[model samples]
Target: MLDIKFIMENSEIVKAACKNKNEQDNVDKIIDLNRMRKIYTAERDELRRQLNEISAEIGEIAKKGGDISSIKVKAKEISEQVKSVEEELSIVEKELDRLVLTVPNIPDSSVPVGFSEDDNKTIRIIGEPQKFDFVPKNHIQLNEKLHLFELERAAKITGSFFPLFTGKGAKLVRSLVNFMLDIHTADGKYYEIFPPFLVNRDSMLGTAQLPKLEEDMYRVEQEDYFLIPTGEVPMTNLYRGEKLSEDDLPIYYCGYSACFRREAGSYGKDTKGLMRLHQFDKVELVKIVHPDNSYDELEGLLHDAEKILDLLGIHYRVRVLCTGDLTFASAKTYDIEIWAPGTEKWLEVSSVSNLTDFQARRMNTRFRSSKDNKLHYVHTLNGSGVAIPRLIISLLETYQNSDGAIEIPEILQDYFGAEKIE
Candidate 1:
C-alpha cells in the first residue's frame, strides 16, 4: 500500500508504473475518492464543532432557567448532519482503499523499461553447461529407465501436473531440502522457520498476493484460508502489524515449504514432466531490513540464492527483470535460470526480489529508529534459495551417465547417501 499523500503527489509516476506493469490505471479514481474523503471529513469535523457549541448554549440556558428547546433542536440537526458526512466519508475511504490495492508498486530507477522477459538484462552467467558424450535424455525419458518418478500414477492420485517421486526420487527431494536448509542456516546467517502452509486472507493480502493473484491460489472456502504459494508468504508475514527495534534490522529467515498454485492463467503452457506443477517444494529466503540498506540487502539476498546453485555445481545465469516483467509487489527482481541440457532450455529456479516498502506497507510492519524515535516501514525481500522441481530436472539431466545412472554432486552425496540412482 502506498501512502495516499505520495500517490496524490506522484500520480503521473504511479500511472506510468501501472502501464509498465500491465495493470489497470486507477490513479484517477483513487485521487477523486481521496479528495471526496477529505472534503467529507472536514465537513463532519466542522459540523461536530458547531454541535458542541450549540450543546454548550443549551447548557447555559438550562442553568439560567431559560428555554433551551430551540438550541437543542439545532444541536440535533447538526448531529444528524455529522452522521451524514461520516457515512459519505466511510464510503469514499472504502473505495479509495480498494483502488489503492490495485495500483502496482513503482519500479525502481535502476529497473530497465521493457515489455517482456526478452528485454531483461543478464547480469552474469556462472559455470559452463555440462558436456555429455552421449545424447542426454530429458527428465521424463530418463525417468522411464531409472524409475525415479511416476507422472501417470501421480495424475491418477491427484490430478495432472502433480509429481509423485518414488524410491530414489523421493530421497533426492528430501536430501535437496535438507541440504538447502543446512546451507542457509549455517553460521546463523538466517533463522530457520517451519511455518504453516495454510494462511488467512490478511496474510495473503500482507504479501500482496490476494487482490491480484487470488485466482491462481488454492483457497479453503470454509475457513477463507489459502494454501501458501511459497514459503515467502508465511515467512514474510511473521511480523505483520508489528513494530521492531532498529537493532533488529536485517532479520533473515529461511524455510522450506510445499507451495500450491492453480496456475489459472498458465493454461496451454508446457505441462511436461517437472516443467510446471500445481504443487512444488522450495526453500525460501526472506529479509526485513532498514530502508537505507534495502538495495544492498537485495544483492546479498541474490548471492545467497546463487550460493545454492554454485555449491550444486550447476550452470546458471542471473537476469535482472525488466519493469514490465516485475511482479506486482516487487520494485526490482532478478531471476536465476539454470541450464538444462536435456531440455535444451534455461529453466528459472529462483527469483530474488527487493520489494522495498511495498509489502511492509501492506503488512503494516515498521521499525523504530534509535536515532530519531520514529517509526518507518522496513523494506522486505524474498528469494527462492531454490525450487526443487526444476532443479531436479536439471540435476538428473546434467549428471546422467551413459548407463542411465545419475551421479549426485559431491556436496550433496552425504545428504543423498550413495546417490548414483541407477
Candidate 2:
C-alpha cells in the first residue's frame, strides 16, 4: 500500500504509475476523500473538546450549587455532534482505504517505460538453445513416446489446463521440486517453509493479490478462503501484522506449493500442454529486508533464481519488466525465460520482484531499528526460485535424445534416482 501521506505529497508520481501500469487513476478521488476525512475528523475532535469543556463547566456549577441542566444539555448536544462526525469520518475512511488499494506501486526510475512485454529490456542471455540433428518434438509429442503425463485424463478428472503426471513425468515433477528446495535451502541461505495451500482473505490482501486479481484466483465457496495462486502469498504473509528486529534485517524463506490460477482474463493465449495451466507447482523465494538494501537484494534474488537454471544446464535469459508490464505489487521485476526448442518459443519460468515496502505496508510488517528505536516498514521481495511446469517443458524438450529419451541434468540425477527417462 502506498502511504496516503506520500500519495498526498506526490500525487503526480502516483498518477503516472497508475497510468504506466494500466491501472485506473483513483488518486483524485482518494485525495478528495482524504480531505473530507480530515474535515470530519477535525469536526469530531473539536466537538469532543467542546463537550469536555461543557462537562467541566457543568461539574463546577454543580459544585457551586447552581443550575447545571443547561450546561448538561449543551454537553449532550456536543456529544451527539461528535457521534455524527465520527460516522461521517468512518464512511470517508472506508472509501479512502478501498481506493488506496487500487493504486499501483510506483515504478522505479530504472524500469523501462513501455506498454508491453515486447518492450522489456533483456539483461543477459545465458547458454545457447540446444541444437538437435533431428526435428525436435514438443513435450506433448515426446510424452506420447515416453508416457510421461496424461492431459486428457487430467481434463476428465478436473477441467482443462489441469495436469496429471504419470510414471516418469510424476517423478520428474517431484525431482524438480526437491532439487529447487535443496538448492535454495542449502547452506542455510533460505529457511524452508511448508505453508498452507489455502489462505484467508487478509493473507491474499497482504500479498496484494486481493482487490485486483481476485477474478484470477480460486476461492472456496461460502468461505473467505482462497486457493493460493503462488506460495508467495502464504510465505510473504508470515510476518504479517508483526515487527522484527533490525538484526534480522534480511530473512529468507523458500517453500514449495501447488499454485492455482483461474486465468479468468487470459484468453487467446497459449494453453497448450504446460504453456499455461490452472494448476502448477512452484518453489517460491521470499525475502524481508531493510529498505536501504532492497534493490541490491532484488539483484541477489534474481541471481538465486538464475542459479537454478544454471545448475539445470538450461538456456535462459533474464528480462527486466517494463513499467507497463510490471505486476500490481511490484516496483520492479526481472523475468527469466527458458528456451524451449521443441515449441520454438521462449517460455517464462520465473519472475523475481522487489515489492519495495509496498507489501510491507499492506501487511503492516515493520522492523524496529536498533539505532533510533523506531519502527519502519521493511522491503519485501519474492521470486519463483522457479516454477515447475515450464522448467519441465524445457527439460523434456531440450534434453530429448534421438530415441525420445530424456537425459536428466547431473545435479538432478540423484533426486530422480535415474539419469534418463525413456
Q: Give all candidates' CA lDDT scores.
A: 0.94, 0.94
10 residues in a row with least lDDT, candidate 1? 68-77
| Residue 140 CA displacement from its true place in model 2, Å | 0.5
RMSD of 1: 2.0
Q: Which pairs of residues collide in model 2?
A: none
- Tens digits of per-residue lDDT for model 1 on 21-116? 888999999999988988888888899899888888888889999997777877888899889888888988888999999988899999999999
The regions of model 2 sitting more than 4 angstroms off are 53-71
Q: For residues 57-155, could you state the per-residue lDDT of candidate 2 as single tens digits?
A: 888888999987776777888888888889889988999999999999999999999999989999999999999999999988999998888999999
* CA RMSD of each candidate after superposition: 2.0, 1.9
Model 1 pairs whose backbones collide: none
Model 2 superposed RMSD (Cα)? 1.9
